[model samples]
Target: MEYDYHCTVCRGHLRIGNKLVFSAKTRDNKYGLIFLSPELGDYTTEHHPDFDIQEGEEYLFYCPICHARLNHTENEKLVRIFMVDEKGAEYEIFFSGIAGEKCTYRMRDKEKEELGPDSEKYRQYFDLPDEYRKYL
Candidate 1:
């Protein structure tokens, strides 16, 4: 699917992708998983949402710092992104920034740990935007 997403800060073309699965731990130490596509935008559901990920569909998940393309198959376990509520009391893990930011928490003991590679814990540290942050 094609979209017209642009970065609000730089007006650069915001890359699009199919979010196959969003698995992370909640603030209460519970695991959660969500599956959806960007084409559906904000109307995602718990099962078989309006958006679908076709076989062999290419999705781009980029780095927040340099905006680089990430390789999902090889770097899935390395990177992660989390979203924290306004109260700072609730949070969730959304994306693992494996090939991009170099999370140290999740990928501890690895050669290059950005923030330890923990998805939920990383969200607690980074001040991510609400919309994009929720998908990770």
Candidate 2:
């Protein structure tokens, strides 16, 4: 099944087909959608000469179409991303990733009974696998 991500604020596409299919590098020197992976994981990023992050800097991931910030706020770890499952159900995913550390991810879902109308389905991450959970 294929899942997709869109910017809730601007309705912009962020991901498609296991890639960062959309891209944006603004005049303000900001880059778009960074999908950080494990040390040896196979992932793709645009190698633009003007796009470079110095040592000890947080990566910036903005929407390619609207340039809205995804992934995080300045100095904030938690990131809220908008996603759609294969069935076309929308969800708001919240997670955290620290700079220079291996990324972490979990898959789980639950009832939205208590949430208000504006809230879509919320899935709290299930316990990660032993290898991933051990380090947390």
Candidate 3:
């Protein structure tokens, strides 16, 4: 089933064809377009050769449409986006911003699901009580 990804700020459609496109910026100020697989847990990515993404390095993500930064304020290492399934169920999707780290989370209300091997890296942040969420 196909799911729609949207920008959390501008609510712009992010999925084009089979990829979710985003504007990415490296720590060195290098910029490029990043195309990511729509499937959760899939780490496949496509980008310009000149815009090298270093593994284990955190990068910034932005909405291609509104230029809104996708980083979650609660966790700089996590990028946030909105998702709607074919049945119109909405979810908050969070994924690792560090290159080569496979971590993705799907959350709706009190229900939460984690995907990818590296998900445990930040799983505790989401699982924490609301009082301690700011610590991450």
Model 3 clashing residue pairs (backbone): none
The residue ranges of model 3 lying beyond 4 angstroms of the native Cα positions read none
- Spell out the clash pairs found in candidate 2: none
lDDT of 3: 0.94
Q: What is the TM-score of each candidate against the true structure?
A: 0.23, 0.50, 0.97
lDDT of 2 by residue, 38-136 (tens): 211222244446556343354545566776666544323434556677898877644432233333332235422222231222212223333443233
Ranking by TM-score: 3, 2, 1
When summed lDDT is taken over every stretch of 10 residues in candidate 2, the lowest stretch is: 114-123
lDDT (C-alpha) at residue 47 in model 3? 93
Better of 1 and 2 by TM-score: 2
Best lDDT among the predictions, by candidate number: 3
Q: Encode model 1's per-residue lDDT on 92-117: one tens digit a residue.
A: 22333222332333221222223333
Ranking of all candidate structures by their lDDT, best first: 3, 2, 1
